[model samples]
Target: MKDMFCFQCEQTAKGTGCEVKGVCGKTAPTAGLQDKLVGATIGLARAVQKTKATEATDVCIKKALFTTVTNVNFDNESLTKMIACVEKKKAELDPSAENYDMAKLWEDNEDIRSLKTLILLGIKGVAAYAHHAEVLGFRDPVVDAFFYKALVAIGSADAGMNDLLPLVLETGTVNLACMGLLDKANTETYGTPVPTEVPLTIEKGPFIIITGHDLRDLHLLLEQTKGKGINIYTHGEMLPAHAYPGLKKYPQLKGNFGTAWQNQQKEFADVPAPILYTTNCIMPVKDSYADRVFTTDVVQYPSMVHIGDEKDFTPVIEKALALGGYKEDKEMTGINGGKKLLTGFGHGTVLGVADKVIEAVKAGDIKHFFLVAGCDGAKPGRNYYTEFVEKTPKDTIVLTLACGKFRFNDLDLGTIGGLPRLMDMGQCNDAYSAIQVAVALADAFKCGVNELPLSMVLSWYEQKAVCILLTLLSLGIKNILLGPSLPAFISPNVLNVLVENYNIGPISTPEADMAKLLS
Candidate 1:
């Protein structure tokens, strides 16, 4: 009957959290449902540990975990079915191991609840990454095992920081592995990305606008739309597709459509094409343009036509044909009035130039590298990212990924040592690319990743971002600046542990934070 949330960031204030319930606007029943869903996912992870990994088992774990990510799946019916599937998996794995009551974790003491919440929510984030990697034909034993271990700890009263702290970092460490696996899957499947310019223009003629974070779905849509006289445009995280040989080779796969995820509500209104969402950061639908919205894979919306396994995509195509896009070629500009945006500075691209990067750093030509990356949200203060990137000295290189880069990605940051000052490293999943680049740079310098002159200033609005942050922490990369606001779910105790162990902090003004970071 009530909502409950622990506001954990600057975006939320007296009105952000449900005073009596939650600042996140989460209802008690929905909160209860989420708890049950997470518990079942833990059970599923435990089941997979007992049994050999199979397509079904992996799908169950991935979909279950990803479904619970913030703003992904909001339907109770879908969640309940997933929970049932997990329970069935548990029964098949160990008939005697009792299913742990998950509600207990939510009902634990405040301090214990806080710490456990960090581990559990953090793992949920990790699970999303692991799931993405698993889909791409990559899997790691270390990453898989931690899911079971962490899930088991959630229900254990005997667990402590001695146990949870390791688990927290383990989530990060495994996430790194998972990210590596995904990097392999992506680069291997789609040839390594190269620096390519992408337009924000919605070109004239029949076209479909694909959004969210799934490359697989985008690939499928590209296949279906080809030879149909229709064009495909990337939106949000999909911008990096311009770098991949697999997707970019499709000639019909046109340029980008909108800026970032948060701008879709305003950007997509009255659009002359159908939009497909394959992942998160989807906003509540507005009536003016709801007819053009379609979702596939893990992304779902009530009353929307969900493209199932059949993946026919007939409806989306039909909508595209009907809309017929622009009357003539429509040229658009990015947030900064730039006619084009660039992407595909993935790990391969970054590492291929490792010699140049190292040399630049050594010669003091490039003094610092900033990973100004993460999810973009509607938070008013998020413009700090754009400002941060704008103010970064010309001598510094900025690496960015996911939808956040749309904030400043359009700016022609010029070049340093034959490379652009700003490099677009694909989607959030491609944070794997960023990690790979960092490791290679470290190796070139003959040092650890932390020893490299790189600072990660991340902005998170959802769970996938959470897992990536944990992976960074797990790798022992210190002094991360996270913004535009912290999750409402992380408690003070958990935050304290993160601050003490990893030195993570919130973002300040671009000038102030950049000065602090560069100094």
Candidate 2:
């Protein structure tokens, strides 16, 4: 049999669909198994769409789709379990229900594949947020309802381009709500994040490196290891945890340990600390620290101990103690050689200073607002984001989120009206905070967001960025620049459709893009 096709991320083979293997190190067998899992999940959704969805239905569907997201789960054994669970759900909901074969969509007309891929990839991103929110005891009915709707639309053979196109944008509408729910969950559980400076040095003794974006897992780990002499350090998207009021109270919660998700292969190799992954951006495990990887929720890799619902960290804690991290204090720094970084300047923080921001704008002290944010990647061109920020004028405020900020996050961009020129707005999920701040600013200025001197220059690396891009488009935001590169799955016709509708284009040089935006 021939290999399966996949192009859901920015790293797809040759900047297009992957045939033999995924660009992110996923093998042909792994890709096929993931496709099978997605097919089974769609079958379960088809079954649940007929019957009223129960809580179990919603949870299972979200987890199933989230698992298929890029770089999330690579273990065929765990995927096999998800497939069986979905089949069982289909049987329970309606024994006669049948799974929609995903190959049909992949092999369909080019235009259909483009539009459906948008909806499919968009929902995969949405499922990640919904799963995060669900674990925090927060759930939105509309957000939950849209998952089934999107899955049904993608699986629908009869749906025309006209149908899938709107559904593609609607995925953004639903994802906005999902992000909102997750923001609420994080705030309510962890308290609002305050502006905080996190150190880059690792103290001597036992420590655990926590990566990905799930705060609940971080919270659980913090609680389980309270007095165990194990230090917890944030890595990747979890870096913002140091700014949350509830989490930062833990004395043993130390500083960050890595630059970005893309550099984990080098950053994590030969590390003394055990790493616990709560969500995505998990690269293939390296032999250097393979024995120390502990995963909970949907993040899975073969042979690594899966932290089940028990959520116990005793095993990870024991590993950290045994390894006895850093014979001496290891001083690390950001890419820019800064010893500290700032985060948690979320919407609540931004809005609290809205009057100062508004006054600065009125006084012409702040000329433009640039949201230079998105997923960071290994691509060479991504240096554009770093240079773009370095080149952004002093009178502008740069807001960033996700792993993309690692490029220039350590550079001291100076302050404007008592606010840092570059503000860290939590994780990718906290794009909700950035949106909130934008809407609030627009309201304060009594102008539409586009008219408020704001521009978004985003870097794309994964499906989460795709959903966030759709959200911005659905809101009628225009002239946005997206790079390191566009998604490989989008056909030229679909690209024309997006460009014609939204005026979004690929990134140019930092100087050229800035000249255009600040002109």
Candidate 3:
């Protein structure tokens, strides 16, 4: 038997192929099955676009896409079942079209291979946002149709860069819509986020540490833990929950725990509380904390307690009680000396005061807007983000999110125009919030998002960040500064295409990049 078979997306095999099996935990059979699922989904997307779209079709597309995300699914049985579901949906939507063979795309020419990779990867990213929106009961036609269009492009060899390039961007544009849908769903469900300070310390007694990007799960946990004498701490992307009015109102919803996803092994090793992972970025668990880790939603780990359909968190609660936390009230601080950090500056809060922001800009009080956000990693170069935010000119406002905020989330940048210079807009998924704020600002200034005197300097460590970047590109937002390291997966040709069309580049030193962006 072959040792491996990879080539799922751009991050697969250096734009050529993957070595030592799948880097994302996929084996030869599993990888082959995923490609089959992707081909079937493309066929389904193509079939559905020809007619009216329905909720069922959208849900099917989303689930299939999510199943293929790195580290999400590894079961061949589940993947094969998903592929069958795609076939059923394709048949239900368009009973007459010939089934498109996915093998054609994989076997196409290398140049065509590069272009289709962009579209496929872009849509994979789009599927993530769509999945999030679907969870919140939101869906859009344009976004749904493009999933088919992108897949159809992958199936057709006639298409080239000229065709796939625009399609890749369309993924970003649709992501904007998908994000808007999610933003609406979240803010509407939980109430608008506002400026609130959350502590980093765990308290005495029982508590739950919730990570991942899903607020619905976090909300449910907060509801279940109510009056149970258990405290809840936000970990990873959930750190921004402190800003939500509904969540913050819970007295036991307590503070934050741990740092970024990469550090979870060391951070949670000795913790006295159970940790819940609602989505991706779950590292391989250590035996020390293995018993205390739990997974809900799409996050799965072997032997860990998984809170399923009942959504009942009693097991997690009991684990917290057994751990019983510290014997006394504990104190904690962020990377800086600050004991508290501020968040909840989502689009609603920012846009509600759009006129004031415009006035501030016109009055020359807020000189620039800097979006220094993305996923944080274990690498050393990441400290540059903390330094970058720290050195931002006093007149500039820095908006941040995802796990990267852990680097400097504790740093107090003071305030500008009665607003903190450093604003945390929730998790990586909340890139939707940052985009909304930018779009609102652009609307107020009567200019495009690019012309709004704002800069996006980001760090990415996983697929979620990849999708967000595609969404940014889809929106035609340019001059993004990306760093820590380039994806070991993106081929040179694909990188060239992004650089030429979108002005995307690796981040240099904060000083040099800042001067260039400001200039």
Candidate 4:
């Protein structure tokens, strides 16, 4: 019998399912526990459909799904406890509802399996965004309701391609709403992001590096660490925290530490400070630095100190002071050898200058706009993103988000019509910002978004990228160039549907693709 079956991420073994161990370093047992957790979540959703869903049920559902996302939780004990919690909640809702068998979906027909996997994984991404917004005291009923609907659909024995295909698109549609909700929650709570330069240098003295997508955790850590003489540095998806007025106000929130999520093992090997993870993209804990690792929210690793629901950061703070950081100031550079990174060109900042952008485009100062964004991975061929940005025409603008920008974010692309040619939007969820800007620009040009001189070259690694791509497709956007590889779960028949309907194709060489896009 297979020890584990998983193909949810782009880097699945041999471009197929992982039958023994996960490429992300998850063991067979850990993968099995995650499957059980997902099964239990499906049961909870089934129960909620029969009875009514309370806020507690909603919170449990989101947390349960988020827990199964890639690299979020690796502790078998935590997974077992989460399964129990989900089962307990399911019983409270309706004792008759039973957990769905994941094997049924996994062993189903190829097209049906492909459609179901898209809906299931896509909502995992939505659940992450919903959890982020929920922690900030924001909730959308539509986004919440769809979680139950999607889980129910996945578990339905009668569900076919026709039924699952629309849900696949609906997953994207709801994710768009969820992303917008998160944008509102973030902007309203932390204030709209402003364009600011973030350094790649690490200062001397005690410090803590916080990674992942949770801003409230960062805000609370910034609050607890105030006047403590310890510095805080953003890592991975948390790098954009330096641009928020609410976060940047903390004088001790130092510059970023490393590049993207995939580089953490090498980048963090010798750091003298504790690293706190607040969300996904955590690799296996290495013995070299396991003692200094801390996690909170949905991120967990065995034996790592986790700041629980109380939001207490004392352990992390104490660990920082214990390490004492570098003896002298440490300078760092990005992948391109640039010493600084610029972020905070979110939708708010971009739309603030819409008139200027519109005028520039009308005068032919801006030829085309390329949104080269999405998650980065450890796989080869990712250099395509770097070379693509470097080869773009001077009159074209490049907008990037998520860790993928690390490939070329530090390059000095200069400017076009008083604006930097390459603009950094926020994190993965900030795909909402990219979509909003596209629609606004389309409105101003009196053309459809696809008709505008824009091309989307996206690189996806995990479920979050799945939902974002679905969102783009549901919006009727076409000709998006996706790479370094297509998803393993997508059946050839389904891929043909996407190519016929949306014209989506895997990326070729940067030179050839750029020429094709321009042509």
Candidate 5:
């Protein structure tokens, strides 16, 4: 990178390149290390193509991509170590293996760079789902194989729009498979999620705050701390844990502690309990709570106690006990002042009652459906999501996923044909569920998905959201409204291609966007 050009996420500075540092709190050194890691990962993928992808290769690419995701790995030391590992693996596989310098991708013609960015970032999102599923012993060799192909395409010479465009859409196809694999792993392992309300109150006593989207880590922590007097409060994407029967059955899996991930700096500054980070969206840990920050898997911070592959959380448990949390029950409210929020309206739950939802639409009880889902950020225009949901017509049903739902999740938009107006569709990974429901609705209505009364008004923040957007576009889902702002990586021409082919564009005022989308 000339000066560390990164515009992978929604919060890119002024919707342009972040030449100095990332708005998400990443340093130049960290970005360079991530670039090197991606380069090494591409080399490894090339070598794997020559040989064959193993379970280990799948694991390596998954970790490499996950590590490069924004806010996941800020510690340059860890990223450098990851690069070394990828290089070593490449050498073992192909003695002639050479790392692809990221400068080539960064300095490429603008349109090529944009398309390649779409593939790389989209795979990063897929790798996240793959890694999570692998943790639970669900591996799709077909999905795993696509990573190598996509990486090779990204690194290949003479590759341009004609070569890379199909791979770009394939990334979405593979990501859908990855998400389906994860959905199976999650549902089979944790039981399909049900509608459940979680309190925002922090129970009195020693506790552990588990952030990120990994339920396996949360389950392990609950197991280790079962009788240890430490209550486990879900934070960030982990908030949906309360709806899973297996997770909620754990008596110690208490209520949620904080709101979305972006508020962690202030919300966790003086948190009395130890905080365990199992995935990304971690802000630079404030010194006030640094000692209590424990990271695992791909999430790493320098000097934080890292719980490695063994998944032994005893260190975190001991810290929680040592810190001895709040003196009394601390009641917290969401931004809306509502005491509780509901989640677990995934495909299973929604499709289980699809008949009623369809009947309601036919009877005009539900006129339109909006899938307002994506990552939440702390930028100026983020409130567009909340306002969009609030202003949706009374007869419209709003389905949400990811941390962005925190904006207005507590509003209790009432019910339509016995279904809540707003249905929380688990985490961003659960975009798989939204896709399933969309395809099903299109089938039922005997029309294309775009022809259905459903619209996707998405708010994106990171690479995962980037991949999800690509997946939607790849599926030919059109006329989608994207906001906060359009991605910075998309040059004017590339965006024109998308606008002409897909009709995707940034959101305007909530009222205007709603009117346009509903029209």
Candidate 6:
């Protein structure tokens, strides 16, 4: 029998499933445990369907699913504990409930499996956002309710394309609400983001590097590390934390330390200070810096120190002080050799400048808006994003978010009408910002969003991207260009549906795709 089977990410082995192990560095055993974790959560959903879901069940379900997300948790011990938690919660909800065997879905017919996988993976992404929102005391009943509904549909023995297709779109529609919930949680908690420039230089002293997407964790760390002589630098998805008024208030919340998530192994190998991971996109730990890596929230790795729910960052702070950071200020640059990265152009910031942007467009100073956004991976051809942004006409605006912006975020793309040519719109969770900007721009132009001279060229690596794509498609957005590869879990039939319905197409060369998008 195959050791494991996973195709949830864009870089699945050979453009098919990974049977021997996961391309994301998960062992066969870890993969099996993750599948079991998901199975137990499904089982819990089944119980919740029969009985009512309490806040405990809701929290357990979200944590279980979030733990299984790519690069989040690799420890079998933690996975086993999570499974027990799910099972225990299931038992509390309904004593007779049983766990669904994930193997059955894996071996099912391809098309049905594809549709269910879409719902399943899409919810996994939703769970992540919900977890983040819930952390900030923000919860949406609609988003919580959809999780149970989708999970039940996945476990249904007689589920078919007819039964699952609409749910798949509903997954997207619900995800839009979930994203909105997260957006509200973030903005209300931290205040609306404003445009800010983040430096890449690392100041000398005891410091901590925080990666991942959790703003609350960053806020807490920034609070605890205050006046402690420990400077904190954001990494990967945490780079956008600099844009928040709440986070940027801390003087010691120093500059960003690295680029996208995929480069962690090389970028972090010898870094002096401790690195705190608050969410996914963590790679397999290297012996070189493993001792310095600490994780909190759903992010965990074998033998890595995890800051538990109490959220005390004492260990991370101690480690940073112990490491004694750089002896002198260290200079860093992004992929394009630029010294600083600019971010914080969320919906609030973008919309605040709507009149100026509208005038620029009407005056022909801004020709088009290209959203070169989504997750970035280690895969080749990602440079296409950098090249595409480089090739865009001077009058066009390039909006980017998530780690994919690392491909060109450092490039000095001159401004149009006093606004930078390229605007960094926070993290992947901030796709809501892009959508809001699009809809508002469409409203300003008195046109449909699809007719607003905007194009989305997305680079996806994981499930979050999947749900966001579903959200975009659910809104009837069309002609999206996605690459470096389409998802392997999407069967030809489902892909055909997307192609016909949404005009979604795989990306080609930057030159050709840019010409086509412009044309």
Q: Which candidate achieves the best lDDT against the true structure?
A: 4
Is candidate 2 or 3 superior in TM-score?
2
lDDT by residue (231-303, candidate 1, tens digit) is 9998887788788888889999879887887688899999889989887656777887899999887777767
Ranking by TM-score: 4, 6, 2, 5, 1, 3
Cα lDDT for residue 19, candidate 5: 88
Candidate 3's displacement at residue 332, Å, is 3.1
RMSD of each: 2.6, 1.0, 3.2, 0.7, 1.2, 0.8
Candidate 3 lDDT tens digits, 1-519: 444545543344554467467655567787777778887887786787687667787788777877676666655766777788879878987877455665566556666775676567667767777777777677787788777777777877578767876776676677777777777777888888898878777778998899877888888998998888999998878888888887888899888886777778888888898998887657667888988988876666556676776789999999999989988877877766678878888777878877778888999999999999987776568889988888899999999888898899888788877878888888777898888788788887789998988999998765567768888887778889998766644567888877898899998898998889889
Candidate 2 lDDT, 204-245, residue by residue in tens = 999999999999999999999998888899999999999989
- Cα lDDT computed for each candidate against the true fold: 0.78, 0.90, 0.78, 0.94, 0.89, 0.93
* Pairs with backbone N, CA or C atoms under 3 Å apart (clashes), candidate 6: none
Query: Which model is ahead, 2 or 4, in terms of TM-score?
Result: 4
Pick out the ten consecutive residues of candidate 5 with the lowest summed lDDT: 1-10
Superposed on all Cα atoms, model 6 deviates from the true structure by an RMSD in Å of: 0.8
How many clashes in each structure? Answer: 12, 0, 4, 0, 0, 0
Candidate 6 worst ten-residue window by lDDT: 92-101
Against the true structure, candidate 2 reaches a TM-score of 0.99
- Candidate 1 TM-score over all chains jointly: 0.92
Which sections of candidate 6 miss by over 4 Å?
A: none
Residue 497's lDDT within candidate 1 is 77
